[model samples]
Target: MDTRTRFAVSAALTLGLLAGCGDDAAPAGSAAGDPAPQATGEPWYDEVTPASASGTTGGAGSPCPVPVSFPLADGWTAKAIEPPKGELAELLGEALTKRGGTTARCEVDGRPAGGGFLRVWAADTPTVAPRAALEGFAAGSGETVSGQQFRDLRAGSFDVTEMTWLATNPLAEEEAARNWALAVQSAGQTLVFAVNEGLITERTDVLPAYRLAVRGLAAPG
Candidate 1:
């Protein structure tokens, strides 16, 4: 597989690992007195997590450093994750770190984690145009439906570009889903955040969450 294809596949698995599928009708989180309902059957990769079961929006534990810290929308649980490693690490180059919305439902590799995924890295382009950076990244993210469509928007004082696409998960064969990404130039680096709604089952609309994350984007003190 080529670079984009590899990136896309890796990302898909990462998502799957975060968003585990299930048949239980129970919501994502359990009530204080209620325990999380047991799944009726094996968790599928394409299970649709209900919006009511959505995650809490906020940082976990301590505050993260600049380029990593950003305010998340409500119904999201955001926190840092280990960086990409080995080949994935080499491919990203110039240092790459990750943060995820653990409660956001974007399932990959059978893992049901969260909806929003964030990556901030050293800029690899001479121009700082967010669209260019977003598109460039998408181009290498394997074969996308009609490639990546982009739009302009504002995230605080920063101008932001959002891109969306339907990406095929080659490893999973029959599975595909809608994916969206936001790119912003901040603190002399490029910040990219993305979310996915699997196509195999009903998809979730996470535009609001994505936009909220954009507004929260900021530089560290």
Candidate 2:
């Protein structure tokens, strides 16, 4: 698979991992004192050092377990779809911690002529650091990633790495051009904030909202 496919597949897998969590999830690989999932050889970031990471409350009475949240901008609307299951679940569940993750999708500009959806995936894993997971997914078969560098940035009190990539259609025969996925990862979870350039003509117009979404995500206080 190409890097593009790796990116999308990894995101989907993260979501699937989230859907697999039972109320009684153990810390990834402690069952038999053995590593449950195969290792990808990716290096982990430094441990989460801060005593408190910034986060927002789930409104007054909302019940979603995800610690982070994203905003729905003017042209955006939430998507309602059943979570992944069965063999699909088995496939995506492997690389992630059994503790699972969370996903949210929204249509942009009501999905106008060229508009698409902005999707975010956040997963909590005992074994994988947010940066390592992001790097692992960004690694595609044998292709080289060009023109981008990972940088340290802060989202509220949470320290994160910001990585940008040219989004492409994974299923296309040739890597067809798409928008962009401005992904940020904190110590506890990975968040992907995507934008469809085809749908929204001016990238600048949507950046502020995207930045706000990133800042809004916070681990439990």
Candidate 3:
């Protein structure tokens, strides 16, 4: 699949590549004692180090008109995505950019770095609460979502509502993958910082980058 198509979330592409598609079993070749899913249903925290590099996005000179600015990890490139013109193109654009009740404004691509994307999605209504916005997003993601967990946390100076879950679609019904998003209110907008990948990589390779962004989340001052 093209990079753009692969980068589109589960709501946009049914391909089992990313954006929450899951697998029922771990990949075939396993070491003697690999970690398995926890009985408590918590997210499997991998042992990778947090990304050690950074650039910024979501400011005046940034590529996207996002509500917040955060670190872009090493090898990830951020891009502002414009809605397509013309009616028919607009329809497809909506599908590619919109999820639940929010629309993706920017994507921090990690494919070149051997990972997925850190997408910035925004809600239409500023009045929506962060938790509600996140719930709507999970429900509308067009995947068989399960093992959802939600919590409140502080990232930079902003209060964040974060959700993690396992999801899959018809194309990847057996390989349900873990995914996450964080919602925050900033600059009169409700924005979601999502770590989305659908590729067949061992251990979602972008989690360190996602964690880095979440750790540095800030309003676009």
Q: Report, for every candidate in turn, its global Cα lDDT versus the true structure.
A: 0.43, 0.40, 0.68
Runs in model 3 deviating more than 4 A are 1-41, 44-48, 202-204
Q: Which candidate ranks first by lDDT, i.e. highest?
A: 3
Sort the predicted structures by TM-score, highest score first: 3, 1, 2
How do the predictions measure up, each by TM-score?
Answer: 0.51, 0.46, 0.77
Q: Candidate 1: lDDT over CA atoms? A: 0.43
TM-score of 3: 0.77
Scored against the true structure, residue 95 in model 1 reaches a CA lDDT of 25
For model 2, residues 27-79, the per-residue Cα lDDT tens digits are 23223223122212111111212112223333213223334554444444443
Q: Which 10-residue span in candidate 1 carries the lowest summed lDDT?
A: 101-110
Indicate the TM-score of model 1: 0.51
Q: In model 2, where is the ten-residue run with the lowest total lDDT?
A: 41-50
**Candidate 3 per-residue lDDT over residues 1-221, each given as its tens digit:** 23334445432432312221233232222222322222221363534555866678886668767767888888887777677677886787777777899988877777678776678888977779987898788878777788776656567767777777777765542567678798988878898888754665534487778877876877777
